[model samples]
Target: MWVKQISVFLENKSGRLAAVARLLADNGFNIRALSIADTSDFGILRLIVNDPARAYQVLKDAGFTVSETEVLAVEVPDRPGGLAGVLDLLHDTGINIEYLYAFVSKSGGNALVLLKVEALERAVEVLGANGIQVQDYHIVHQI
Candidate 1:
C-alpha cells in the first residue's frame, strides 16, 4: 500500500524548521516520521504525519512550498543484512529506489523504512510476491 508523504521546500534560513514544527503542533498534526535534504539555499523536508490532508492544506495556507507524494512504508527486521535482503529483492526485480530513510524502529524489533521507488506498482507487486511486509498507513501509525 502507498502512504502519503508531505514534502516541504524550505529556504535555508534559521527558524524555518521550527516554524513548520510549531505550526503542525498547533494544528494538532503529529509527525510520524521525517527526513530532510538540503543545499546552501534550500532544503526539502519530507514528513509522514498523522493527518496528511490537513497537514498539506495547513502548510500551503501558510505559504510554505509543499507537495504530497506516495511512498511505501516497508517493515524490515532489525538485524544485520535485513535491509540488504530487501534491496536485493528490489534490485533483482529491476526496481529503482529513488531514496530511503530510516524511521523509528518501534515495532517489536522490526524497523520501519520509508522507501520510494520509480516503479510504484511493479515494486509493490514484486515485494508482495516475495513476502516482504509493505506497511499501510494504519500499521505505520501504530509503529
Candidate 2:
C-alpha cells in the first residue's frame, strides 16, 4: 500500500524547523514520522502526518513550499539485520531505493520503515510476494 508523505522545503536558518513544528502542532497534526535532509542553504523536511492533505494546504497557506509523495510503510523486525534483509530483497529484485527512514512503531513491537523507491508498484509486488508486510495508510494514520 502507499502512504502519503509531505515534504516541506525550508530555508537553512535557525527557528525555521521550530516554526514548522509549531505550525503543525497548532493545527493538531500528529507527526507519525519525520526525516530531514539538509544542505548549506536549505533543507527538505519529510513528514508522515495524520492528515497529509490538510498539512499540505496549511503549509502552503503559510508560504512554505510543499509537495506530496507516495511512499511505503513497511513493517520489519526490530532485531539486528532486520533492515538489511529488506534491502537485500529489494536489491535482488533490482528495485532501487531512492531513500528511506525508520521509526519504532507506536505499538512497540516492530520497526516501521518509510521507503521511497523506483518502480513503486513493482516494489510493492515484490515485497508482498516475499511475505513482507507493507502497512496500509489507514493503519499508519492512526499511529
Candidate 3:
C-alpha cells in the first residue's frame, strides 16, 4: 500500500528543526518516522506522521515550504544482508529507488523501511509477489 509522506524544506539552522517539531507536537501530530537530508544551506526533512495530510496543511500554513509524496512501508528481514537482498531483488526487477529510511523496531524482528521509489505501483507489486510485506499507514503508525 502507498502512504503519504511529508517533506519540509528547512533552513540549515539549529532552531529551525525544533520549530517544525514543536509545531507538529502542538498541533497533535504523532510522528511515525523521520529522516533529514541536509546541505550547508538547507535541508529536507521527511516525515511519516499519523496524519500526513493535516500535517502538510499545518506546516504550509505555518510558512514552511512543505510537500507531500507517496511512499511505501516495507518490512525487511532482520538478519544480515536482509536489506541488501531486497535491494538486489528490486535492482534485478528493474526498479529504481529514490530514497529510503529504515528502523528496526523493538517489538518486531523485522526492520521497517519507508521507501520513495521511481515506480510506486510496480515496486509494490514486485515486492508483494516476492513475499515482501508492504505495510499500510495504520500498521506503520502503530509501530
Note the Cα lDDT for every prediction shown: 0.88, 0.90, 0.86
Full ranking by TM-score: 2, 1, 3
Please write out the lDDT profile of model 2 over residues 26-110, one tens digit for every residue. 9999888999999999999999999899999999999999999999998887889988988999999999988899854643477
| Model 3 worst lDDT window (10 residues) | 102-111
Candidate 1 Cα deviation (angstroms), residue 78: 1.0
- Candidate 1 vs 2: which has more TM-score: 2
lDDT winner between candidates 2 and 3: 2
Error of 3 at 5 (Å): 0.5
Error of 1 at 40 (Å): 1.1
Residue 23 displacement in candidate 2 (angstroms): 0.4
Please list the residue runs of candidate 3 whose C-alpha ends up more than 4 Å from where it truly belongs after superposition: 104-108
> What is the lDDT for 120 in model 1?
85
* Per-residue lDDT of candidate 1, residues 43-133 (tens digit): 9999998879889999999999999999998878789998899999999988889999888655656888899887888887887888888
TM-score of 3: 0.93
Residue runs of model 1 more than 4 Å from their true location after superposition? none
TM-score of 1: 0.94
